[model samples]
Target: MKLWDYDAFILDLDGTLIDSGKYHAQAFADAVLAQSGYRLKPYEHHEFFGKHSIWFAEDLNERYGLSLDPQEVLKHKRERVQEIFVAELFAGAQAFLEFWCGKKTMALATNSPLEFVEPALRDAQIFNCFDVITTASDVKRRKPDPEIIEITAERLDVEPEHTLVFEDQLIGIKAARAAGAKVIAVDNGQPVNYPVDVAVHTWNDLLKLSELHRWNPN
Candidate 1:
């Protein structure tokens, strides 16, 4: 297949650029268990992988009658994630990003709070790759809201139509598309039922694409 060209880039943090999904998933499971004695199903891990912590908590509460306090659930999840999570970038993510750094102006737009994001990327040694960073704390809205993506584009001074986004979660994909950017769905063992421009299993798969498609001047 051919590439969809673009001038700027946006990436999702947890699953798209890093290998932190399992840790996050486990953290959610542990948090739920601790809060209400409920065990999250294996599929629940990725069901809301890219959403804000509060949203996940609300979903759990609404669906299971757990009455989980969003803040409390977030606290539990964060504590567990911090204690047991190993900060690691996905294989080839750093290499692929380094390759693209020379070619594109990239930004990070994740639902993760600023505190978690900065340290995670710093520890993973990929924090400096982005020209702009927009986390949950930076905006009033979260994924599927388009605020974060829109802000990232503005910070990069790139037009939304000229931007391309890498996302692994359906929520991220929805937000990227809502921001009017092309979406490349990164498969991180999660199922995305959205209509994205392209889907790949790893950053290397994109690196191997024949070419990245560029904007057409009419």
Candidate 2:
């Protein structure tokens, strides 16, 4: 199928449309350090992508053998994220979204909580682009569980098999696949090694590819 052949488009927030992964990682690192006095190893933050803060905190506890409260770490990380995070959309992300605004059924699905997701979308000025928005708070389980993606597809009133998910992390891709959606790995410098139906380095590449498919939004 062509890039624009899908009935709906589901996009992951961090690392996919926005470049906030570093901020998220830093916030998590700070939270872990403040709570457990253990610094996260370099690139350890990448492992936490596409997961809820509580899940990440629990994982930290298990990995480091620390008796840290997941709730406390989650709270601290949220506060740090609010103070430090600055939404910066990936190149051509706004354009791609704008181009498909009224042309396709779209949803923003992320493991990030609504507290973080809302402001980021608003800051990026693409909050209104999606027909539906699904966040961690909206589901009992996050990415890699398929609940988030499933719910997003349902909310968009589209079948998972007819939806196309754009993700950066393997967990999100796994969830999308599990939900029965085709996956497009959006590489933001760090390339995804997982198998996907399509892979593009940036939103610009996707835009060009879509144009080549001759699928007009009109």
- The residue-by-residue lDDT of candidate 1 on 1-218, one tens digit each, is 13435778889898888888888889878988888998988778777566667788898888989878889888899889888878887776887787777677889999888888999999998887889999988999888889999999999988987898888887888898899888888865566675634565567677655233333322
- Each prediction's Cα lDDT score? 0.81, 0.85
Return the TM-score for candidate 1, rounded to 2 decimals.
0.87
lDDT of 2 by residue, 65-145 (tens): 888788888789889999999999988888888878888889999988898899899999999998899998899877888
Q: Which parts of model 1 are misplaced by more than 4 Å?
A: 1-5, 196-201, 210-218
Clashes, model 2: 0
In candidate 2, which residue pairs get closer than 3 Å at backbone N, Cα or C atoms, i.e. clash? none
Candidate with the greatest TM-score versus the true structure: 2
Write down the RMSD of all candidates, one decimal each. Answer: 3.5, 2.3
Model 2 TM-score (2 dp): 0.90
